[model samples]
Target: MTTEQHIRHRADGSIDTAFYTSQGRTRRSEAAHSMARGVIGPLVILFSFGTLVALLV
Candidate 1:
């Protein structure tokens, strides 16, 4: 087998490289989600308050 294939498969015939890649991707996605929420959350609150004020006036 090639070196790439060897790294992907272990002696027990299970995939190992995928787990590491998947964990990395999950962590990246979680971080992005947290950042987006941090930015959008305040904007949403501000917009809602402005709308309420506009309606009251």
Candidate 2:
């Protein structure tokens, strides 16, 4: 039950966050991209819907 063992035992796969060079980017970059998309996608939709509603009013 040590820290390293606990981290390595996640339900997902390996806990190591190191990125493979074959992928051409680090895991940190991937996580950032995912987070940006998650935030931006909703914001864009909300803005478009609001603009449409405003035009109708």
Compose the digit string of candidate 1's lDDT tens values, residues 4-48: 543466678887877779889999999999999999999999999
TM-score, every prediction: 0.72, 0.54
Best by lDDT: 1
lDDT of 2 by residue, 1-57 (tens): 656534433356765454434344666689899999999999999999999999999
Q: Which stretches of model 2 miss by more than 4 angstroms?
A: 1-25
Q: Superposing all C-alpha atoms, what RMSD in Å does each candidate have to the true structure?
A: 6.3, 8.2
Best by TM-score: 1
Query: In model 1, where is the ten-residue run with the lowest total lDDT?
Result: 1-10
Cα shift from native, residue 35, model 1 (Å):
0.4
